[model samples]
Target: MDFQESKTKENLARSFAAECQEGARYQFMAKMAQQQGYQYMSMLIRTLAHNEMAHAQQFFNKIVELGGNQTQNIEITAGYPFKSGELLDVLKQEAENEHMSAESIYPKFADIARDEGFEDVANLFDMVSKVERTHERTLKKLHENLSCNCLYKCNDEHAFKCDECGTIIMNKCAPKTCPLCKMGQGYYRIDFSIN
Candidate 1:
C-alpha cells in the first residue's frame, strides 16, 4: 500500500487502542461504583462507556472510509498496580492511562499525519490529546478529594471498606496506604458488612 494508506492504518490502530483502554476503565469504574453503592458514580461510568464506544465506532468508520480493514483488537489485561478497587484508584488509573496514551500514541499519529500530508488529521489527533489531558486533570482532582483524610475521625468497629481500593479503615485511621495494592491510604474505602 502507499504511504497514506499506511499512515491511515496506523492512526486507526492507535484510536482503536485508546478506545479499548477507555472502555476497560469505564467498566471497572461502573463495577466499583455498584459495589460501593454509589449510584451517581455508576451512572456516570456507564455514560462514559457509551461515549468511548461511540469514539471507537467513529475511528472504525474513518478506517473503513480510508479503505482500510479493521486490523487491531482490544485486550483487557490485568489491572494497574496502584488500583485498589476504589473510586480514587479508578480515577487515578484512568488519568494515568490517558496521559500515557496521549504521550506515546498521539505523537506517532501526528508524525504519520504530517508525513502523509494530512494536517487536518494531525490537528484532530492534537485535539484528542488535549481532551484526554483535561480528563486526566479532572480525575486527579476527584482522587485528591476522595483520598483526603483531614476531617474524618471515627473509631467505629465497622470500618467502611472502599469498594474501589478495598482498604479497611478503623476509627478514621484509614491509613493513607492500601495494604492490598500498596497504593496510598487515600484510595481506601469504609468496609461495611450487611450482617
Candidate 2:
C-alpha cells in the first residue's frame, strides 16, 4: 500500500478499535452500575452502548459506501488504556479517543468525498468533526476532576521519583507534579503501563 493507503488503513483500524472499545466499556459500565444499584446510570450506559454500536455500524457502512472493502480485519486489544473503574474516567477516555479518531479520520473521508464530488458527504463530515471537537473539550473537563486509584500498581520507587525534586510521589501523583518543586508531572521519564 502507498502512504495514503497505509494512513487510511491505520485510521480505519484505530476508529474501529475505538468504537469496539467504547461499546464494550459502556456495556461493562451498565452491568457494573446495575450491580451497584445505580439503575439510572445502568440504563444510560446501555443506551450509550447502543449508540456506539450504531456508530460502529455506520462507520463500516461508510467505508463500503466509499468503495472500500468491508472485509478488512482489525485487531482489538483486551482492555481499555485509561482508568476504567470510574465512570467519568471511562467517559473521558471514550470521548478523547472519539475526538482523536475524528480529527485524524474524518478529514480523510472529507477529502475522499470532495474528490468523488460528494459535497453533501463532505459537509456531513465537517459537522462530525465539530461534534468530536466538542466532545473532546467536555471529556477534558471531566478528566480533570475525576480521580481513581492506579489501575496498575508500580513497585519501582525510582519510577515515581521526580527528576527535579527527587521526591517519591505515588503513581497518581507521578502523573501530576513534583510535590517538592511543583514541576509538571509526566516530565520525569517513567514507563507507563499499556492496559
Candidate 3:
C-alpha cells in the first residue's frame, strides 16, 4: 500500500490537528486559571499544553517523513470539544477528554495503523496513548484537589514548593502566601505525581 494514500496517513494528520487544538485549548484554560489567581495551577496547565504541542510536532513530522504531506492538505474531519465554565469543571471535562483519547481514540488509530502495515506509526500512537492516560490521571487529580480546597494540603507532614522563589515549606497546608516571594498560596504546589 502507498504510504501517502493510506488511512494511517490520514490518522496522522488528524492526530496532528487534534493535538494542536488541545494545546491551544489548554493555554486558554491556563490563562483563565492565572486570571483567577491560581498561578501555579496555570503553570501546570501550561505544562500540559506544552506536552500536547510536542505531540502535535511528532505527528506533523510523521506526515512529512512518511506521507510526504508537507505541501498537500490532508483533508481530515474530526470533532473537538468547545468547553467553558468554572475552572474546576473545565479541568474535569478535560480529564474526560484525555480518557477518551487514551482509551478509545488513539488505541483505535494504532490498531488501524498496525493492520495497514504502518508499524512505526502504530507504535507512535501507542506511545501517545500511554501519555494521554497519564494526562487524564493528572487532570483528574488536579480537579479533585482544587475542588476539595486541598491543592496544597496533606494529612501527614509534607513539603510544599513555591512556584516562585523556590521556597520549600513543610506543613500540613501551604501558607496563605509564600514567605519569601509574597505570592499567594496559589503559587505553591504539592507533588501530585499521578504516576
Candidate 4:
C-alpha cells in the first residue's frame, strides 16, 4: 500500500520519531536504575528500550515502503514532568506517559492505521498499547511501594528472576545476594501482583 500522500504516512513518521525518542529515554532510565542499585529494574528497562527501538525500526521500514522519505527535516518538540535527578518523580512521570499512550495515543493511532487498511501497523500499535498499560501498572506499583518503604517487606511471596544469573526463586523478600551469581537483591525481579 503506497501511503505516501496520505495522513497515515504522516502519522507513521511522527510515531517513528516518538518511538526513537522513547528508546533513548528508556536507556537513560535504565542507566539511572543501575546507578541506584536496581539492577533488575535496569535490565527490564533496557529490554524495554530495545523494544522501543524495534518499534521505531518497524515504523521506519513501513514509512519507507510507503514511499515516504526523510528529505524534509522534522522539528519534534516534547515536554514531560520527569526530572533525571529524582527517581520517584521520574517513575511517576513515566507511568503517566504510559497511561496516556495506552489509553489515548496508541489507540487513536491503531484506529487510524486500521481505517487506512494497514492491519500490520494496527496490530503492532495495539500490542504496544497493551505493553504500555502493563508498564504503567508496574511503574505505579513501584512508585507506591518505594514511597511506602514496602518494596522489600510486603510479606508477599512471589516468584523472582535473578537478573544476574537468570535463576528463578520464590521468596517473600529480595535476597541479599543471588546464590548463583553473587549479585545483590537489586538484581532480582520481584512480582508485585500478589496481595
Highest TM-score: which candidate?
3
Error of 1 at 89 (Å): 2.5
C-alpha local distance difference test of each model: 0.61, 0.56, 0.89, 0.76
List runs of model 1 lying over 4 Å from the truth: 1-5, 68-85, 149-195
Per-residue lDDT of model 1, residues 1-195, tens digit only? 453346556666568666866877787788886676554346556776776777677666666666545444423333333344567767777778778756866777777776787666677677767766766675675566457732123455447454454555555555554566665443444444721
Tell me the tens digit of each residue's lDDT in model 2 across 1-195: 232243343444455556667778778867875674444345555776776676667555655665355445554333345566566656666666767656876787677666656565567566666656665664454344333423222444434555555665445335554567776543343333321
lDDT score for candidate 3 against the true structure: 0.89
1 or 3, which is superior by lDDT?
3
Cα lDDT tens digits, model 3, 44-143, are 8999999999999999998888855344877888888887798998999999999999999999999999999989999999999999999999899889
For residue 154, model 4's alpha carbon misses the true position, in angstroms, by 2.6
In angstroms, how far off is 126's CA in candidate 3?
0.7
Q: Better model by lDDT, 3 or 4? A: 3
TM-score of each: 0.60, 0.48, 0.93, 0.79
Candidate 4 lDDT score at position 101: 85
Tell me which of candidates 2 and 3 scores higher on lDDT: 3
Please give, for residues 14-121, the per-residue lDDT of candidate 4 as tens digits. Answer: 778877887888888889888989877777778878877887888788766656464354344544343565778777888888899889988998998888888888
